[model samples]
Target chain A: MTPQELRLACRDGSFTTNTSGYCAGYVQANLVILPKSWADEFFVFAQQNPKPCPIIGFSKTPGEPVIRVGGKDVDIRSDLPQYRVWRDGELAGEPADVSDVWQDDFVTFLIGCSFSFEEALLADGLEIRNITEQVNVPMFNTNIACEPTERFYGNQVVSMRPFKAADAIRMIQICSRFPNVHGAPVHLGDPSLIGIEDIQKPDYGDAVTVNEGELPVFTACGVTPQAVIKQAKPPVCITHSPGCMLVTDIPNSKLAIF
Target chain B: MTPQELRLACRDGSFTTNTSGYCAGYVQANLVILPKSWADEFFVFAQQNPKPCPIIGFSKTPGEPVIRVGGKDVDIRSDLPQYRVWRDGELAGEPADVSDVWQDDFVTFLIGCSFSFEEALLADGLEIRNITEQVNVPMFNTNIACEPTERFYGNQVVSMRPFKAADAIRMIQICSRFPNVHGAPVHLGDPSLIGIEDIQKPDYGDAVTVNEGELPVFTACGVTPQAVIKQAKPPVCITHSPGCMLVTDIPNSKLAIF
Candidate 1:
């Protein structure tokens, strides 16, 4: 389906769940909307740390509902299927549409997500464990710290896939081509080193099987910005409810810097 | 210096040592010349395995001194600083020039070498340990087997460097750009996994100090082909003397596919 068609369904509340497996070949983004007071610090946070928080689209001025980078009528407030409203570092509600509560001071952000690299990996014939198991990619909270802005500070979050030694090398190469989509893996083998005490238990997403002789490869994840923003505790923040993404018209190939 | 000028110097016997650290921005190649009887099998072997033995230039016809891909006036017999004459796997002699032994059925193969990526790493401000220590890069034989032809079969040979985990990741990404030049590392950490019994006792080159927290990163070495050639024990095989490469006018940047 086209991004516009998907957005139209989302706007009318007909599509109200995960954006995965929809709008194939197009870019899918993580949505972040914050009050103007906190947007500047978040931008600085993304600049200081790009791999985890690659900003693909952003609102130019406060109260701007449309993000032209994706479409002429891309309304951040109503395009996504679900929105997570956070108040003072806590989840206030999970709303399908935030237009009723939208404020004039809101600024939208669309950060690049792993869906782009996942597409690239699949194209290369590499098996992404989470996809094979028919579950969301397992994500972990890691000990690797992100370069912080004064207000935004937190440990990095990484997604994992299991591959044997040789496949891990190939996965690294394929993913490296899409820098906007978290680039190469942050760590491989020995989850403890990255501070993930248990490979079987993920903080987010379903845990997939890691077969014998396979190493779990970890990449910087989209959940990082969400985790960081929560710790910062801005007065009011809105982000895509988990797995609900802003599907854009851009093809995944466009993300390749080469 | 221009490739033509450098060739003129080598032909005149003014340049008779390792061709590295000179011809700053150009590609340096590993030379392998074999009689026509063995050339076809070796070509298949190289094709079967590109990462360890990427062929950058090859003679179109056997016994042709002309290397068409390298340059218009390039002569295989005299451009390299030194040549090693191997007689049934034994080093028969080392000569400054091989024009006397040049035959109508001899084919020249210019395989990619690691010097290109070392130059790239240095340009990226990553310290190449061997260059920093002013010593030869340490090399070892690994359990990883090369795809063997009828007569050519042996364990893989790898060159080693030490880097912290983060720098190792960066090195992998950088080296990946130049596939012809050994490409990215074959393995990192736990030498026993790849059958390198001791990191300190490399089969070739002097072992430098691997810092306490640094991991030993291994890359498929150009020496693998040479090692295979040695094991095959061909009646008449020739190679560039170690460190004495066939410097081409092709810039290292041209090797980067991206």
Candidate 2:
């Protein structure tokens, strides 16, 4: 289905599953809704740490539900498959629609997601290990610190994909073209160098097998913002439920710089 | 001095040393002059195996000394600092000028050298381990074979440089922009994976230090053509002596694709 159709289904409470593997060529994004007061500082934090929190689009005006930057008639309140409403940075509910709890001071941000670049890599014939194993991409907490703002600060989190050295090089080239979605990998080869203590034990997602000769290539992850927000203890914040992204009308190719 | 002046010095029998650091920011090529009989097949070989044998320019007509593609008034016979004269695949002599042995049926091919990309990497503030340690970049014969023509067939030869993982990623991005200069690295991390038994002992150049936390990144080298030509055993073949290259008027920046 077209992104508008899919989003309409979501708005009507008919689509509540993970958005992965839907609308093959379209861009999907991680959602972030914050109070206008916290959002300004969050914007600075995102701009400062783009690899983990690249902002692709956002609400033009606070409390306005329409998001024209990413698509036509994208409502920030109910267009996504699911959202996690937070109170004091603690999960308050996983709701199919947020119109009930939506605040007048809310500012919605659409952050670039890895799904776009993953489509690019798969199109280029590179195997994504997580996709092959039918699991979430492995993610880890690294000692690599993010550039911080007064209201948001935390270490960078990274998602892992294992590839042979040559394939890893090709992967780097492909990902570099889509900077909005984490760009090139932040690190590859030794995980310990980035303070990822165990390659097989990820902090956030299920660990996929790292073959004998394959290197675990790490890209900055969107989960970084969630982790940072939790640490900052924002009074009210909202984010997409894991894998239940906001599918957009924008084609994945639109994200490629080259 | 300009490349023309440098070529004139070589022509007048005044410059007889290596051209490694000379004519900065200009292209320096690995020279290969072959009899017209062997040139055709070698051209096909170079075209098929561009990573190791990227041909930047060649003689417009057989026996012509002037190379117009890369520079003005480039006399292949004496434009390089020194030339190695080969007879039946064996090194017959190393001379400052080949005027005494210039063959009318000779066709010269200028292969892209790593110096162009090294200059690029250094300009971007990336340290080249070979330049820092003051030695030749280590080269190895890999199991990765080149696509061959009838007369030219051999495994690829690669030059090694050590870099931390992040620097290697940056180096890959920088080098990818200059495909004429061997493009991105062929393999990185493991030497034995490419058939090199020992990282400390290279088949062709001096071995530099591979410090802790550094990967030995490998790029296909110009030496592969020389190795192939030697194995092909042409009646007469001419090449630049080690570290002596044919300096051209083309700026190194001209090689960048984007």
Candidate 3:
């Protein structure tokens, strides 16, 4: 379906599943909703740690639900298939629609997700192990610390994909074109060097096979914000449910600077 | 000295030393002069294996001593600081000027050198182990074979520089912009993976320190042509002596596509 159609299905409560393969060429974004009081500090956090938390677009003003930056009819409340409500760093609820808990002082941020660059990679004929294995991309917490703000700060979280050294080089070149979506990989080759203790056991997402002759290439993950927000322990925060992203009208190709 | 001044000094039999540090910011090329009878096959060889034999420019016609493509007054016979005269694939003499050996039916080819990209890496603050250790960049014969023509067939020769994974990634990005100068690294990480049994014992050039956290990044080397020439056993071949290159008027920045 088109991005608009998929988003409309989401708005009417007919599409509660994850929006991964629904809007193929369109941009899918990780969502973060915060109060006006905490939004400025969070913006600073994203600015300082752009590789992990690149902000593609945010609400024009506090309490503004319509994200005209991505699409004309994008409603922050009902456009996403699912959202995780955070209360004091805890998972309070997983709701399909968040209009009931919407606050007048709410600010929504649309973060560039890896899905965009993943599509670019697949289009260039590179195999994504997570897609082939039918699992979420393996993600790990790294010792590489993110630049901290007054309220939000944490170690960087990275998602992994395995490729032979040559293909890994090509992946880096292709992904480098899309700076909005984490840009090039942060690390490859040795995982222990980046403080990832075990390759088979990820802190988040299902582990895929890292076959012999392959290097586990890591890119800064959008989930970093969720991890940071959890550590920061904001009184009220919201984020997209895992794998359930906001389908934007922006085409994935549009994100590539080159 | 400017590239032209250096060329003038070489032409006048004054500059007999290597051109490594001379003519900064300008292109330095590996010189290959072949008999007209052998030039066509070698051209095909270079076309099929650009990574190792990227032809920056060539004589306009057989017997042409001037290369107008890179500079206004580049005389192929004496523009380089030194030339290696090869008789039946064996080095006959290393001469400051090749005016005595200039042949009417000779075709001069200027192949891209790694020095262009090495300068780029240094400017970007990436440490080149060879430059820091004051030795030649280590080179290895890889199992990675070049696409061959009838007369020219051999495995690729790669120059190595050790860098931490992060620096290696940056090096890849920077080198990619200058495709004429070997482009991005051909392989990184394990040396044995590419059939090099000993990382410390390179087939050509000097081995530098590979620090604990650094990966030995490999780029296709211009030395591959010299190796191919040795194997092909051309009746009469000429090349730039090791570390001596043809300094051209082309600015290094002009080679960057982006």
Candidate 4:
């Protein structure tokens, strides 16, 4: 479906599943809405940790309902398939829409997601195990500390995909073109170095098959910001449910720096 | 020294050692000279296997002694520090100068080398183990077969360097910018996957430290053409002695596409 159609379906309560594989050519973003008091610190955190939290679009003005930069007529409150509401870093509710809870002092940010890079990877004839296995990409919290800002501090969270050495090299080259979406891999080979205790056990998301002779390639993941938010414990924070991303009109190719 | 001065020094036998670290920012190329009879097939082989045999410049005419494309006044016979003369695919001699053996039908080719990319990696503060250890980069003959021509056929030869996963990713990025050199790495992680049996014992050059958390990254080596030429058994072939490259006036940065 087109991004507009997907957003419309979402608004009408007709589409409530994960947005993965929908609107294939358009960008799908990780939605993060915060009160104005915490937005500045979160923005600084993203700037300092670009790979995981590459901000593609943000509300130009606080309390504005529509996201003007990332897509035309993109309503921040109801465009996403699902929203996870948080109160003092605790899970409050998983809502289909959050328009009722919208605040005048709230700010919305659209961060780039791995889906775009995965599309590029698949287009290049490389196999992504998560897509093939029909599961979410495996994610782990690493000991690699992030450059922190006031009220925002945590270790990096990385997503893992397994590939043979040569394919991993090609993946690096391909992903390098899409920096906005966690460009290139941060680690590969030994999991111990990154504090990932077991390759088969992921801290978040479902673990996929890591075949023989394949190395687990890890990229800084968007979950990092959520992980940081939990640590920061803001009075209120809202994000898209896992895999339930905000579909945008912007073409995925537009994110490529090359 | 400037490339011109270096060439002059090579011509006069004032500098007779390997040219690995000399003329820091200039492009240093692997030299190959073959008779016009075998040049056509070798040229095709180079084109087919560009990562290993990236041809930066070649003689405009078969009998021309001076190379004008890659650098100025580069006399094919004496511009390199040392030359290896091969007869019927056998090593005939390693000579300081090949001016006396210059054949009218000799066609000279300057193939791109790893030195250019090494300079790039170093400039980015990444350590090159070979440069740090003051030794030649370890090279291995891989089972990864090369696309062959009628007169040339062999497996690829790759040079290995050890880097932590993060540095390896950065190295791939830096190398991708210089495709004229041996672009990005061919294989990384398990050495045996590429048919490299032992990481510690390389087929050519000295092995450097592969630190505890590091993986061995391999790049298609310029030596691949030399290995293929050996198998072809051309009546007469010549190449720059290992590490004794032909320094060019082209600045390394000029090769970066970005």
Candidate 5:
């Protein structure tokens, strides 16, 4: 289905599944909604640490519920497939539609997701092991620290994918064009240097096969802001459930800087 | 001195040392002059294997010693600091001047060198271990086979430079812009994957320090074609002696695609 169609289905509680591989070629974003009090600090944190928290679009007015830049009639509260509600940094509930719980002071942020870059990598004929294996891409928390803003400080979270060196080089060129999607990779080669203790184990998502000759390339992940927000312990926060993203009208190609 | 002045100095027998660092910001090319009978095969080989043999300039016609595109009044026979005369794949002599041995059927080729890309990497503030160690960049004969031509076929020779993964990503971005030189690195991370037995020992040039956290990034070297030419056993061939390149008038920045 198109982004609009998929979003309409999401609004009516007819589509609660993850949004991966849906609305192909269009941008799928991680949704972050918080009170205006915390929005400014989070925005600054994103600006300071762009590799992990590259903001693509945000609602123009608090509680306005529409992200005009990413899609027409994109309802902030109900357009995403699923949302996890947080109360004081604790998982309060998982809701398919948050229209009844919407607040007039809530601000919505749309951050670029890795799905767009993975599409580009696949188009270039490089195999994505997670996609091939039908599992979530493994993610890790790293010793690399994000530039801190008041009430918004945490270690960087990264998503790992293994590739041969040559393909990894090509992937770097492809992903560099899309800085909004975490740009080029932040780390590669030995994972231990970045504090990754086990190659077969990850903090989040499923671990894929890492062949003998392949190197594990890690890119800054959008999950970082969620992790940071959890640590920051805001009064209340809402984010899309993992893999259940907010489908946008924006084309994936539109993200390429060049 | 300018490249023109350096060429003049070379012609007048006033400067005979290696040209690695002399003509900063100008292109220094690997020289290969062969008879017209063997030139077509080499040209095809170069076209087939661009990463290792990116041709920057070549003589317009047989016996045309002047490469007007690369520099003004560039005398192919004597402008370079030194030349190696080869017969039946064996080095016959090292000469400062090849003007007396130049034949009417000789065709000259100017291939891109790593000096241009190394300058780019250093400009981006990445430390080049070889440059820091004050020795030649280490090059190895790899098991990576070159695309074969009728009279030219051999394994590729690669040059190694160590960089931490993040800096290596930046280096790849910087080098991608300079395709006239060896573009982005061909392989990285694993030396044994490409048949490199020892990181400390290289087949040609000096090995630089590979720090504990750094990966040895390998790029296809201009020397691959020379090794292929040697193996092909062309009746008579002449090339620039190692470290003694043909300094050209083209600005190094002119090679950047962007």
Candidate 6:
């Protein structure tokens, strides 16, 4: 569907499904809306650590749900196909819309997502195994530390995709151009060094095949900020339901800072 | 030594030592001066295969021995510390001055060398294992095919350096900015995948220690053109001796097309 059509469907509660394969050229973002009191600390956490929490858009004022970044008509509360409500940093439940529960003090943040660069890698003819297998990219909890804010503290979570040495080099070159979307990979080869034991079993998402000669390449996942928010235990937080992202009119090509 | 001082010393035959560590900030080049009869095919070879032979400077016309690229009063025949002569693809002899043998048909081509990116890697605080340990970077002949022209046909030769994962990423980022000097790496980790039997036994240059966590990163070397020239069997070819380079007045930063 077109960006406008998708937004309208999302607005009218007609198209409440994963936004992955839809809106081909546009940027779909990971949503993170929190109370103003908690938003400040989260902003600091993101600023201190950019790779894991790249902020593509944020509310200029609390309770101002009309995000100018996604487009003039893009409303954060209704645009995303689904949302996960968090009470005291614990996931309460995945909900279709949060506008009914939305408060005047809540702020929205549209963080950059990996789907943009995945499109680029695919265009370059490099295989993204998870997409081919029709599953979410296998993600892992790593031992790598993140610089903490007052309340936010957690280990970085990474998403893994396997490739041979040559393809991994090509992936690194392609991803380096999009710093907003987690930039280049954090680690490649020998998962054990990054504290990931059993490459087949992932902390989140479905496991994909890693062939005989492939090396597992890890990128900082968009799930990292949500992971951090849970660690901080902010009173209330709302994030996009997994794979149900905020599809912005912003073209994925715009995300390339080059 | 400064660029000017080093060139002056080389000109007077007072400094016959290798030019590797001298003239730190300036661009040092791989010199390949060939007879004009063979120049057209070689130019096509370099153009068709730019990653392996990124030409930074080429003479306006066949030999009148002076090259304006290096500075005022720079004589190509004598300014480099050492030169190797090749006849019919076989090593003829080593010569400090090729003035007597310099033919009007000789066309000089100065290809960008790794010195530019080595300085870049060092500036980014990534260790160049070969430089730190005071040894030449190990290079190997790879099975990776190169784009061929007429007589110039051979597999690409690659230079290897080891870095831990994080440093390797930084190296890629830095080198990506210098395409004229063989931008970015061709491969990293498990050299055997590139048909290199053992990292310990390099076909050229002394091998250095690759630490426990480090991976071998390979780049298309400036040595590739020389390897191709040897296979081409040009009646006569003149090249700078290994470790000896044609130092240009251009600063290393000037070579970054970005």
TM-score of 5: 0.97
Which candidate would rank higher by DockQ, 3 or 6? Answer: 3
- In order of DockQ, best first, we have 4, 5, 3, 2, 6, 1
Q: What TM-score does chain B alone reach in each candidate, compared with the true chain B?
A: 0.98, 0.98, 0.98, 0.97, 0.98, 0.97
B154, model 1: CA deviation in Å? 3.5
lDDT of 6 at B110: 90
Docking class for model 1 is acceptable
**Total clashes for model 4:** 0
**Which interface RMSD does candidate 2 score?**
0.7
lDDT of 2 at A74: 86
Q: Which segments of candidate 3 are over 4 A away from where they belong? A: none
Model 5 lDDT tens row, A92-156? 99999888888998999999999999999999999999999999999999999999998999899
Cα distance off (Å), candidate 4, residue A232: 1.6
DockQ list for all candidates = 0.39, 0.71, 0.75, 0.91, 0.82, 0.70
Taking the tens digit of each residue's C-alpha lDDT, what string does model 1 give over B1-258?
787778778888999988878889888899999999999999999988787899998998999897978864888898889999999999999998999988889999999999899999999999889999999999999999998899988888999999866677788899989999988888876788899899999999999889876778899999999999998998998899999998888989999987
User: Which predicted model would earn the best DockQ?
Assistant: 4
Worst 10 residues of 4 chain A by lDDT: A68-77
Runs in model 5 lying further than 4 Å from the true structure? none
True contacts kept of each: 0.11, 0.38, 0.49, 0.95, 0.76, 0.51
How much DockQ does model 2 earn? 0.71
- Residue B79 Cα positional deviation in candidate 4, in Å, after optimal superposition: 1.6
Error of 1 at A13 (Å): 2.2
Q: Which regions in candidate 1 have their CA more than 4 angstroms from the true location?
A: A190-193, A198-201, B1-6, B66-73
Question: In model 6, what is the error at residue B168, expressed in angstroms?
Answer: 1.1
Any idea what lDDT model 2 has? 0.92
Pairs of residues at least 3 apart in sequence or in different chains that clash in candidate 6: none
